[model samples]
Target: MTKLFIATTALATVLTGAAAAETIGVSIPAATHGWAGALNYHAERTIARLEEAHPDLDFVLATTPDSATQVSDLEDMMATRGIDALVVLPFESEPLTGPIKRIADSGTWVTVVDRGLAQEGIQNLYVAGDNASFGSTAGEYFAENLDEGAKVVVMRGIPSTVDNERVAGFEGAIEGSGIEVVAMDHGNWNRDTAFTLMQDWLSRFPEIDAVWAADDDMAVGALAAIEQAGRIDEMFVVGGAGMKEMVARIAEGDETVPVNVTYPPAMISTAIEMTVLGLTSGAPMTGDFIISSELITQENAEDFYFEDSPY
Candidate 1:
């Protein structure tokens, strides 16, 4: 017999008059960057708190380095743990759709966070940061601050649905603003990758005015490149995700790093918490839970700053 079958049979014999424990499986990408590191941090803490609070809820957490590993992790969770629910942040949209759909099809409640699946209606609860607003907020700042025909570059994150949404929002916001995007490329949301991409853009474009490093980690890389090129004063940068350091710089009225957009990595906590609540409390948790994004400027940066935050 399968382990799940054996365990269920044994539990039924031992707990004839008691409630059985339910399991939740959480699978996400490994901490490949600063934002992802923060995500893992929040997920771990949330899981610990929930496990302690709800003794009948068992959690199986897995961090995968890539989509293939994530797929394998899900298979193991199902085969061995017999999880009742699943919470996932896909490494990439396309590769994970089939695997996650299969899980959902097996009657396992699915809560998708951050990066969405390629297929729709597969997840019971969807929790994520406002990716479109995250982009548009930064775009609005660039539109208001830069002159007409000002040249700028962009650094995008890993190719996923959220990245697409953020870029679309940014493009739509700057449609008629006349702030030209001279170059755009993927930074994979890695500081080193962004640093290299920014270096290349600096060498090719001599008159760049601003940068929209879609992520704060990329912004740091781009800033380093700009400084190395001695072009720090010529251009400013806008990045999303209120990394504490980035918010601090904005609060101090730094000219090169003036503003930021909020895309908290802690949204993973929301997904895990809501999923557990839905399973245990029978509350209405179906549907999207989108947290809105806000711009962080010198006037109100203090409101967003978390001095003890890891991100």
Candidate 2:
């Protein structure tokens, strides 16, 4: 419950002092897309503010393009930096689990963010967006907005527990609601993959009443394909993760993008800040911190919009 404020000019001397006593390493995925880009932006800004607030704390941030690189980054952080704590968003669940467990076993406090590890109890703290709410919120929109038995297609993200929870929540929400999912496939959270998959679904199904692209990147691809096929007017698309462009469209009353469910990239800031507080203030931070998702409509889109944000 400790709050960190930006330090005033009086602490300028600490700015040039020796390295801080505690080192917290942050390893996250590279800015491969809009969502990840915003995530990186938030992480960096949070670390910067925390650094200024507490000169006794140090931070090491690494962005990895893949699981292999992320594993290597963790290894190097453990061996060379001798980080006292770690905040990691695993590239994938399975491959990074053992390596992260090894780090935890070595007495390092681990905080897992967003994508979870395959094995539980490995992290001292867990911070992430509510994947189930991310899905169910979108599903509820579909159930209320679409007609009974309306057909739709779904695009999933990468294979992980996060993706699984979202899909499961969606399924549970629409159960017996008379909404039918005509087709579903993995878009891997990539725009191109979703475009290709959407194109194929268009070819097979004569009618698609709506689309749940799940992530904003996949939503862009689905929209492109839908527009290309000249079926833009036939169905609307609902995506999660609150990409700035998509929220803007929703604000502008774009029919194709009527609404968005939020899974904020800023959750990284929560994890980093909490980890620092636990280390510096001796506060208890050994538990899950789940940030809830909300539905973004034109009525409140401006509240979620950030003009300065990269995503």
Candidate 3:
């Protein structure tokens, strides 16, 4: 009779109480670029450690290729996973706002990472590297490092609020500078796309002094294009985000990559850590956590380089 009772209780626990487990859902973009790749690595590592540390905690980690699929992932998590909390890094802000807001309305704790939603106040907590600071810092580096009459080309990322802020901060800092922005185009934060754009620029323009590829992945692409065009000696590249490889190049004082801007992908780990704290501890996570972006030069780039880092 005792054995029967024990079996019955175990069955009930499996069938009905799993939803009662403390579940956290993580949604982020697929690793389409170097930054995104690092984000994925840190997120998975964090989730593994958290799950081991707290056996009762459950994690549902999802990656989306685009905004539309991300919406479906959110809905699926809500419908089937019984998530007590959600941590999202939006693929695109506007398309994600409504679905995320609906999740919040369902009483799920929401912590947004990196890119924000189109609508504000939808998330209970927001954690991201300061986009404005990233841009201005990169811009200021140009203003200080390059010549007054330098010819620089701009490579932009996808259309989003973060991108806009980065561009605005960069432009604001370079105001009245003798630096001429010869060409501007959206690289969509993709390496191949930036390669194509740079190739076109090389073919069209006889002289290109410098290029700001915005993101590290784009910078790599731009560099390849420059090498292929045999313009490596003519120009230098400035890329944001402290990718390990990029940081290493800067640490070695590579002339082509003299400096990089810090926009670490490990910010995803930060958001996950804070969200886990909010979930486990009595203190809830609220308001904004903006990470500062800084310059990575030869003298300081060694500090940013991690030998075994995935990115």
Top TM-score hit: 2
Native-to-model Cα distance after best TM-score fit, residue 103 in candidate 3, in Å: 1.8
lDDT of 1: 0.88
Q: What is the C-alpha RMSD of each candidate to the true structure, in Å?
A: 3.8, 4.8, 5.0
**lDDT per residue, candidate 2, 1-311, as tens digits?**
01121132224326655444787899999998788899999998898898789867767888999999999999988987788999999998899999999999999999999888889999999998998999999998888898898998989998877899999999888888899998888999999999999999999999999999999989999999999999999999998888989999999999999999999999999999999889888999999999999999999999999887799
Q: Rank the candidates by TM-score, best first.
A: 2, 3, 1
Candidate 1 regions off by >4 Å?
1-18, 159-161, 306-309
Question: Residue-pair clashes per candidate, as listed?
Answer: 0, 0, 0
Q: Rate the local accuracy (lDDT) of all candidates.
A: 0.88, 0.89, 0.87
TM-score of 3: 0.87
Candidate 1, 1-311: lDDT as tens digits:
23643465457547755456788889988887678888888888898899689867777888999989999999998897888999999988889999999999999999999887888999999998888998888888888998999998999998877789999999988889999999989999889999999999999998999999998989999999999999999999998898888999999999999999998888999999999889888999999999989888899998987665578
Q: Which tens-of-lDDT digit does each residue in 158-242 have in candidate 3? A: 9767789999989988877888899999998889999999999999889788899889889988999999998899998999888
Looking at model 1, report the run of 10 residues with the lowest lDDT sum. 1-10
Candidate 3, residue 162: the lDDT equals: 75
Model 1, residue pairs in steric clash: none
Lowest-sum lDDT 10-residue window in model 3: 1-10
**Can you tell me which runs of candidate 2 are displaced by over 4 Å?**
1-20
